[model samples]
Target: MTTLSQSGGRRLIDLVPHIVLIVGVLIFAFPIYVTLIGSTWDSATIGRGNLPLTPGGEALVNYGQAWSESHGARASYTPVRVMLLNSLVMALTIALGKIAISIISAYAVAFFRFPFRMAFFWMIFITLMLPVEVRIIPTYKVVADLGLIDSYAGLTIPLIASATATLLFRQFFLTIPDELVEAAKIDGAGALRFFVDVVLPLSKTNIAALFVILFIYGWNQYLWPLLITNSADMETIVIGITKMIGTGEAANDWNLIMATTVLAMLPPIAVVVLMQRWFVKGLVDSEK
Candidate 1:
């Protein structure tokens, strides 16, 4: 009886964690669930606060309308399709740019011994303390002065150089065996050839991880994109979604807003799901 009781107690204790985890997941996911359900209902139903748990009949209509064109109750009449494309371009550009710049920055610092290299690296690192909020005005002014305002260059260029990615890549590069470096050098491979062959292949997981993170970062950008682009077609999906809501007696098309929100979520979700393995390995695994 005592042994049986102890076993049962252990099982109960184990079950407690699973129960807590399930509850936590439900708590986080509930808002998404509500948004999803609300997207299917009409504006009148939502405005009347009839937030049904089950999806309603207006799913197709809401999504179709959101996809093709804005309700224009709040913001521009630009189609969500154009906004989505803009967002995709911005996100891809930022991700690829950050990766390209960071990897090269890290490679130079890690492999080459130069005057004040560490100082330069620390200078790059110091930028981390200065968040976007601190640099926004000057960045905006510079971008405007450079004739890049309302352009893709303004949207992506100011945001691409990432100290964090550089730091991460540098750390990873440091872990590489010295013997490998020596062997590559002995084979008469130039710096570029060695980097292309040896370094990049090993950094694959890390690159994938940073790409996912940077892509999401760019995709969810609100303030910078909002400030940079005019409130027109160049606006990203995030800006578009926010613009869809009405304020102060301007009757909102809640259905369309929710549909846009749902659409906005999909790309990032797809990225995370598809890159789950590489992302996890890059972040957690130390093995080369």
Candidate 2:
């Protein structure tokens, strides 16, 4: 009877956490739901304080107007298309670069021993404590000197080396058995060969998780891109959206702004949802 009661209590504890999580999810999701419904309405209707319950078949018209006005209103260029392509290029470059550098660096640190090894590791790890806001001005100057401003390189290169990626890969690498490396060496396998054949195969979950994270980070970067990009042609979706919202004394198109915001969020949401399985697997593997 005591054992049964203990199990019941433990189960109830677990149930409490799950119930709390569900409530939190709903609370966060409410704004997104509101925005989605608001995207289908015009400024006048939304201003009347009507909660976006149903789109009432106005979705098409709202989307069309938002796209046309924010983009090339007179057939010059589509803001959505341009900003999307810019975001894709920037996000993919940063994600791939961060992953590549992080994997190589983490593998080296984890497997090889050399002078200043701990120092080097600590130096990199310490970078994580410093926020990007502190270094933005210097970073901007460096990029400007390199003539990367208003270019893809300017947008992507500065974001390539992430301390977080290095830390994550290092933790994942530590979880790998040393015996595997020894076995590879016994078979006359070189470092590159071992990494390619053994380490990478086991790291799929970690890599997938890292890719999703870095992709989201790169995709959502706004301040850096805004500061560096002087041309509308070079602006990202977030910047374009901000421009739409307008400053004081300028009329803000709330309906179009909301519509664009919803559209801008689609790619990230799709990525998370699609890769959710891998993300869960990564977390589980990390715990193990």
Which candidate comes out best when scored by TM-score?
A: 1
Off by over 4 Å in 1: 72-77
Model 1 local distance difference test score: 0.91
The window of 10 residues in a row where model 1 has the poorest summed lDDT is 69-78
User: How many residue pairs collide in each prediction?
Assistant: 0, 1
Task: List the lowest-lDDT window of 10 residues for candidate 2.
Answer: 69-78
Score residue 205 of candidate 2 by CA lDDT.
88
For model 1, how does the per-residue alpha-carbon lDDT over 1-288 read when each residue is reduced to its tens digit? 999999999999999999999999999999999999999998888888868899899999888988996553444446779899999999999999999999999999999999999999999999999978999999999999999988899999999999999999999999999999999999999999999999999999999999999999999999999999985779899887676663434567887888889988999999999999999999998788
lDDT tens string, model 2, 1-288? 999999999999989989999999999998988888887776667667775587645677767776655442222233666787888899889999999999999999999999999799899999988899998999999999999999999999998998888888888889878787788999999989999998898888888888898899999999899989998788788888877765422355566667778888988888899999998798776443
- Compute the lDDT for candidate 2: 0.82
Residue 54, model 2: lDDT of 79
